[model samples]
Target chain A: MEKKIYKPTDIDIERLSALARISLSDTEKESFSCDIATMATYVSSLLSDVSAEHEREARSLDELREDTPVECDCARDILALSPSLKEDHVAVPLVVGKDKEGDA
Target chain B: MNELIFRSLDEHKRALTAREYSSEELTRAYLERIEEKEPSINSFVSLCQDRAIDAAKESDERRRNGAPLSALDGIPYAAKDNIAVAGLPLRCGSRILEGYISPFDATVISRLKSSGCVLLGKTNLDEFAMGTDTETSANGRTKNPLDENRVTGGSSGGSAAAVAAYEAPFTLGSDTGGSVRQPAAFCGIVGLRPTYSALSRYGLVGFSPSLDTIGILSRSASECADIMNATVGADSRDATSRPFPASDLRALIGKDVRGMRIGVVREAIGEGLSEEVLEAMQVATDTLRSLGAKMTEISLPHLHAAYAVYYAFSSAEAASNLSRFDGVRYGYRAESCGSIEELYERSRAEGFGDEVKRRVLFGNFALSGENREKIYGRAVAMRKQIIAELSSVLSRCDLLLLPTASTHAYRAGVKKSALYCKDDLLCTLAALAGLPALSLPYHRDGKLPVGIQLMGPAFSEDRLFSVAHLLESALDRRESAK
Candidate 1:
């Protein structure tokens, strides 16, 4: 099997930052690209060296928690902390169309 | 009052009980010290003067009524900024959560409060508890109390520094990788990362859920034990917490380790270790031997990969956990954003420091598509292997002894890449295994301090305390003789 190698590019940084929803400046992009590439290379080596003989079964979910309803004592307080709120509802920007569709 | 600020928690308790000093006086002394030293150390992000004094007054009333709480009653301590304290700002040393107040106290805080322990305030940490040096904190960098030009090792640097500088008798520091233990070493104090789930993490801001642990930093092993006794228990709020047999940890201290089998991790001392750290390890081993504790060299062959594994898992978890700060419900919200996406991007971009952004980006990459199997999956497997290896080795020994860090605390702003991972290399092994580890100040090279670390199997905190107490006394005697 061919050993995987990672060399992060500017495109990779842009894609990842988009996924993480974090904007980055050009300087941050260049620097983080290098750091990510270095770390990826290191993790690749660790993956390749992992012994396959010690593979164990996944944990059983027998202890899965039951669905139980509990009241949150600070529910009102939590909502009050929102950046924008309307009638006790946490108000967010419309996800679908732009301003025209939502307002109309 | 000046001397009162430097005394141990137990001593403060004794003095408080004897009416030699009031809890109000003790609290005021610490507050004054914090006021004086905080400018130089930058340890506290917030000072709870009004709250602390009120709590101290209440504690004095309780003491007067002959109803003292736990051993730590009337004693003041600080919490890392990540731990939630009711009505206090939970900035987490980041600009994102600035001015965000916690509505409720964390389970540990409530436990401490119920025991009459007064809160001094929240100390600084690496932003989101992501970095080893507290330098990454968005609030500001914490300077080592011992040397102003040097860094107080982080992400609990401020907490460790507060205790070391006598601003607080002890403090709570959360350990994900080496957050607590590393800073404790750097600040010349004692820090313990208890077994994962030994202490409740219900109120701690999440970093890496699997590895994040609430730990204690103090002037002595006994004090750490005392605090642990008060805080350690099962909590319904945190499902990961489990019930353990109740034991008095303070009673375990001062007991001799006559037949304790200590394992010296051979790989920990090889290459990358400094001469002073190596000498300190040697003296630690000899001191343990002199105290009649047996020592044997043990190896964890896969230990070298600890940093890689730790970063992979912790970064991935951090990415998921921090996504909650999306400029929506709470935290910093960017103004003049055209869309929700822009809101998130702008807020996080402005809020997170470089180190945090770097890790978050790496996390996203690690968990995406094929990289999930190649990176995250394999790292998980490696973690299991490492845990198994540690468990096997620990089966033969009572504890594993090693240096907490490869070298003494470095000067502030030493931007060498090699120094970044060095803090976690020696300490991550125990963290990965979910075992308890303690870093105790061992040797001081001129002004800087070196700490020796000990790792014990799960729930072996009592035994670790006993061994550490004996070793601390032995080292003290040797120092006094010189």
Candidate 2:
């Protein structure tokens, strides 16, 4: 298989920054140039072998599970683990910005 | 007889079912032994007295009522601390999770409990399951039970040590590369890493989601097989959990391997293999040949790149899996952090051990935005090639037999040459291939034990176990005569 060449444009950096969940300074970005491009090239290779031809559309991660009975005990555990649970619902701080897509 | 502790797990189960021993009596004896021998070995991070006694009482009650859960219902088992057991501290041998408790039991633990197995407690492991030696554990290094100055092979060192110390009959461990089998070999026990996806990964604190599998350590291959049979199946909660057709497999002991082809991977048996280890492999094959198994040599071209591939993928997975430890919701968050960032860095920096931080840094470097392709990406591709090469070779062979690890257990923190230091990777090919592999105790060179690794096609665990059982019997007979 011929390798794909990738250039890390500003948008690619933005995506990677979100993926890594670490803020990058300008010098950090400059240092990361070759690495970002390299990783993108590799990801594209794995994507090539995925054979998306079998599926008409890719479903979201949460939608991947089949319709099945949800165990009450499991749900209880989730609620018990949540820090800000109020009447069986988890409370979370309002986000400063929306999350990047396709991160999962 | 303490001989029961050394017997095959299957035999003990059968004997227990035949009214030979009550579950209560067995649990009591093991508990007493753990109390006596566990201090020096440091095999367990936590001991589940209440849970074990409760289960034992219930088991005795069931027996008195003329009903039994299963032959293994009352069997006591230990779990590596990396695996979660509800209400028990799931400390991954790191200070970060020192006081952390799991909200739910790991799938394997839950399955064993459902089958009436008693939870002995959580065994020790390397911190966050990062190091090859268990010495990096925050809870102190687990000393080899056989030779205290020598180390128990790790990061599943405690799981192996527990079985060796007879603190528990069997234990569950995770095998990413050779964590389970390497330690088992050192501890002179049987460790089975079932084919990838055989058991669910849910509730396991140890990361490396793609490569990690729940493995079993037992005194005998049949005992390992029994646990595998109970734990291997599909779980809707686990996205990668695959079904293993276990019911149809016969537990063949001393079965003939007439016309069966066995390949010894040249890459797996390389330079620096100890004289004892090399001799053990030769003797094992000679015995297998006498049992009618044909042997040949096979080469995996990508085997040289297999370790690199494993580190890349395993670390990348590690980087992602460990991101949850920000001290936000639970676990050991920083106590005196001035701010959120301080809390995050200090909690991790202070809580994690030196080896863990080093690997995480390395993993972060590989998985970082700039270098992901050169390291993690190349490694993934290499992983595929290794698996493909392994698959193609398996079409011509019924099994592959080789050394489990290049050499026997080393003394604590004794570093070998660069080539020899990393020789553990030689035996991890079957792990990377996602094939079912068995490490059976073959011989002990008076320093520590060496294991004979038997690898078979993916999902061919029963057949692999059958061969291992035969070999184990032959070795055991020889040992007894000696």
Candidate 3:
């Protein structure tokens, strides 16, 4: 028995949007549903028949660049350019705790 | 209009050597023209007036002191905004990176600087270079220089327009599936997507890492070679960059095209190609044949699937590469959010344009766990097939000729979704194979130019530009004779 090819119309835009971490408005959601469906249909129609699988050859040890630390002169400048910095490091929102607003 | 702005790099060098005009005068003339034409064209995203003048002054001093840097010394050129020029805005034509400025120059920018090329300003592009037309830009659309109503095909439209409008002699652009070549074709200029890794991608903002190549747009193939000669080399910063010694790219210029083996892509010339474009290709073929070149018909089996393969791989890479913009370290951040996840979602949703969001979502879909093997995996295998097919054909022929685009420049408001496949059909093969390709314009009198592409094997830029130079010369002679 042969397997059924996935249909482009079956794409769950809400799920993909969640995975991509993009919050789409109602109108955008409607728009993307159609756009993604069209693109997927186009791609699926072309690629469904292809089954060839090939991988690039692994590089020899000598071909790889030696793993060594390189000097970086713009660390201070990079840090300064950050929008939110705490002391010497970039500040991020607490991952597993009350929000900054709650703490305040 | 100042004729100085229209001179080729070589002509400028010669005139400067003869003391015809100082670099300052040339730079100012370009700046003046840019100021006058910018209101209607809207090609530039930002200008570097003071710094450009300062660089010009320094270049003049170097020449006066008999210590000139390189052949490009004092030449004014614009770069696509995505390429970082230290202290300049690095917006990538997206609202997400609105206030961001690059802290350091990209490797190419530093290399061009060392060669004493004056930076005019940064040009507009598609948001994150994700779209075909410049209409997707957060900055205003870049109108075609020849016709304001029509678009300068993007995502390197601004760079092409700058050259077409004589705002600059030449400019730098990035091609990841025909961004550079398509725009150059529309604007009737020369565009080169050099062999992958021929030039370092250290400072270039990544769109699709594997396919993204820093391309050159100039008035002529010889000028493209001049710019490439100064910029092509390996950089430690870009691990994919190779130690290419293919310097003196213009060495074969003016060489006889006699007995040169050229293959015309059979599939590319058939249905879906515009009639005028086909006519232009016919004329180009006759011109090359008249010059004693051997032209034959060739076919690539996988050419039909190139667009699908390109969208899958490029979108996946784009999704991963863009994951760095999480509203944390750099770029725009959301105003208020409950958690980090919400912050990420809101910032990305509010910051990115519609086309970008669609691609990002589609990319995530392709790379998602259940669909990876079915979509992204298949694209990988298909890409290898394309590479194999192209490599095989290139082995037989010295060069492959095809249309750079299906049609000439179209109106600005034409949506991206409608022309999706047709727009990218001709340009994706070179990007997929990581081969060098050049787009040279050929057109009838007072008509929109049609670009004919020349593709060659990897690291074959020297030959590619040489043949392009030959064809360009033939066309120029024919044009002048008219």
User: DockQ for model 1?
Assistant: 0.32
> What TM-score does model 3 achieve against the real structure?
0.90
Q: Tens-digit lDDT track for model 2 on B206-248?
A: 5687778889898888778778877879888788898877673
lDDT of 3 by residue, B284-348 (tens): 78888888889999888778889999998888888888877778756899987999899999999
Model 1: docking quality category: acceptable
Question: Could you give the candidate ranking by TM-score, starting with the highest?
Answer: 1, 3, 2
TM-scores of all predicted structures: 0.91, 0.82, 0.90
lDDT of 1 by residue, B113-189 (tens): 98999999999988888877788888889999988899888889999999989999999999998889999998988
lDDT of 2 by residue, A1-104 (tens): 34466765532454444443444456655546544454445444433332232111222211556679755857875654445756976666433222533211
- Point out where model 3 deviates above 4 Å: A1-9, A51-104, B418-421, B476-482
lDDT of 1 at B175: 94
List the per-model TM-score of the A chain: 0.49, 0.44, 0.42
Q: Which candidate has the highest lDDT of all?
A: 1
Best TM-score among the predictions, by candidate number: 1
Evaluate candidate 2 by giving its C-alpha RMSD to the native, one decimal.
Answer: 8.0
Model 2 CA lDDT for position B443: 57
What clash pairs does model 2 have? A35-B370, A36-B370, A39-B373, B73-B116
